[model samples]
Target: MVEQVDILVVGGGVNGVGIARDAAGRGLSVWLCERDDLAAHTSSASTKLIHGGLRYLEQFEFALVGKALAEREVLLRAAPHIIWPLRFVLPHQPHLRPAWMIRLGLFLYDHLGRGRRTLPGSRRVRFGKHVTGEPLRADFSVGFVYSDAWVQDARLVVLNAMDAARRGVHIETHTRCVSARRDGEGWTAELESRDGSRHFVKARALVNAAGPWAASFLDDVAHVKHQHSLRLIKGSHIVVPKIFEHRYAYIFQQPDRRIVFAIPYERDFTLIGTTDVEYKDDPSHPTITAEETSYLCDAANRYFKKQLTPDDVVWSYSGVRPLLQDEAGSASEVTRDYLLDIDQNGPPLLNVFGGKLTTYRKLSEEAVDKLAPLLGNHQPAWTADARPLPGGGERDIDELLADVRATRPWLPETFAWRLVHSYGTRARDLLGEADGLNALGEHFGADLYQAEVDYLVRHEWATEAEDILWRRSKLGLRVTPPDVQRLTDYLSTKR
Candidate 1:
């Protein structure tokens, strides 16, 4: 049987799923397919920040910075559980950048975006009196404090997919769009699942939101020709033991003028990244090179009193950014802004190019605004004023945590906190009628239990151990090898 829909969205990254959610909300029949797990590649690998690019101000990218800053507040309000305010401490290095220049950049960041009501603005801090100073080198007597937000990057993608499914969008993960043919007034796409089962769908419009494969998918899979090109820039990050006990994150500026972040991760580790190297290899399997690892370690060592080496790195990840190709001298200088190219010569086709995580919501809204009108649908733009994503209704997460502990007194403090932060109000759904920890089922190391795993598999499209451990939650850091094997065995039986 050939299914029909108003739109066929290729790719399951933030941009793709965000577009699907917007289109579905407008009463359009939407079908989205991904060649791999949602956020298996680029989306999962990020510095995990939601902020206006403060450094981009050096390049005079005021508009992009302003747009991102505005979206930061919207996202914080929309997903308070997964997104929260974070303060960044930038150590003073007069040789790299003058103090006046740094202050000017931060001032613009604080005032550029219009609706900056919630988060506190940037300020200067005396390291000798600040907690962030205790971990810094002695030379760093003065630093700057700025406000940003942290996000569970992978969970954001899953939430968008979940919301799209609720709005009648069909989401197919681990399913590849083998070929797409433009028929008279629509597209007939051949989709292949992991087991080699084939299915067909016809749609009025086609959307290519494939992140790194945006250009390749057009030439090889869809067999369409376009002039757009993507510059694949590989960024790598190394995770090591926590460098400091403070809650504040550090943004270090290297001599090369590129910035690297050392953010607290998984409650026990520090995430240091990322080196910008032009990549020509397969985007699916990007690994952190030894040189890149050394670079990150050295970058962190420059700022923190606790020095690091390559051996200290417990885990590392890399992602290829499909940035828009501009005539930039260095890969790091490439613009983080996005472009939406729409072809109206025949059946409408929209191609999303060169976007950052901070601006994905606006990018998706713009993509739908352009493509939705062409499909004979005049649904007004939404998603800005819409209700929060699933499990994101509660604004005060600390209060929610208090309530969870008050009600489920048997649940450990750590376990209850993780639940409220990860699943928000839906944590109640996972607990169900369970009265104690035993009812939560078998333990899988750390605070992970079978009940949580079941909820993820049933709701969040978690398939493999990595998806559940690294992406869905950072339990991989605490789980032993045998525990992971047990999880794999359990998933196999369920399959």
Candidate 2:
């Protein structure tokens, strides 16, 4: 007898996991598979902001902006630890955009989609009075301060998958759906694991949420007829030493009618990014080009007093965004909005295309709302008001931090902050019955210990150093080559 499920989701990106979580919560048997580790692609390679795309307003994407804004509010409530409020300071460049236009855009952003219930509204600020202006060039006399939120993007994807697993969704990472064939009664597919183990699955419905590979999955695996096209655009980011010490992040308006952000990342570095170059290479192995690095440096240099060079870049990453093809002129101008295509002629099928990080929950809810009914699941949608994601139970993050400090005074301040912020309430479980750092286990490097690695491998499906160091956490930035080798050795035993 072959294994079967109500839904078979192909992809482990944000949308794939989001759909699994929603479907499982609504009482559906779901099985989701990913060829690589979860969020090892576009989901982890975001600009890490949970904002209504402020620049999109110029393109008149009002509906998309409002939809994203509403999702932002919901996500904040559901995952307070990994996702929290962040203020952005955009230095005024009169030539690029007028002050009134920005003010109008901010007003609309603040009030869109039920308005700013918990986050602060945007306002104009003078450079002479504000602290964020100190790092900017002397030419910027004034700027606008607005509210958005920052995310541990990869962690967001993991938490969604964990929550889905809790709700009885079967998650298979490092496993690929090699072939999927739709029979009139249901769909059957062959799954191949990384270790060469194989299995078959039958499903009542299939969802192709394969981020950058959605179209390819349809063309190759599902063998279904469809007209959707995905324009692969590569966006790259460079990490340099901390350029600004302020808590606030910067969003610089580029002369090319684009925007680049300089945000505090991993405590010690500033994250600057993102060029919209059309890409034709493999999505999995995308790396930042020298030109992209210089472009980002220049984008920051235009407004920042501390100049950046290619040598200053400590790390870099690039991800191919599989945007839904449109008639847009430039790659930068393409819509970040997603489209959910559902075909219900025989066994149901759903396809998700071209979505940004900010709107995954809404997209998932909408996807399940369409597919769940076809499988006879009449359960009402519940993820919007559902319980918080894994380890995000604590609403008052500061209070939780204070309590943890009071209880574990031996824990270093920075270490404690990282723990509380990264794992939240689950930090207690990871530190269970331990009084000192040494008890946590062998030191891998920096603050990483054997205990944390063990916890990750057991709970978060972390099988390799790359998954733990880069995706699950940014500890890769602080670790040495030998340290990585040691981690690799340890994970090899685990796998």
lDDT of 2 by residue, 120-221 (tens): 888889998999989989988899999999999999999999999999999999999999988868999899999899999999999999988998888998
* TM-score result, candidate 2: 0.99
How well does each candidate superpose onto the true structure, as a TM-score?
0.99, 0.99
lDDT for each of the candidates?
0.92, 0.92
List, residue by residue over 1-495, the lDDT tens digit for candidate 1.
999999999999999999999999999999999989899988999999998989999999999999999999999988999999999999989999999999999999899985846888889999999999998899999989999999999999999999999999999999999999899999999999989999999999999999999999899988888999999999999999999987899999999999999998878899998889999999999999999998999899898889999999999999999999999989999999999999887899999999999888999999999999898888988888889988999899999999889999999998898888889899999998889988989888888889998999899888888989998898888899999999988877765
Reference-based lDDT, residue 404, model 1: 88
Clashing pairs in 1: none
- What's every prediction's RMSD, in angstroms? 0.9, 0.9
Candidate 1 matches the true fold with a TM-score of 0.99
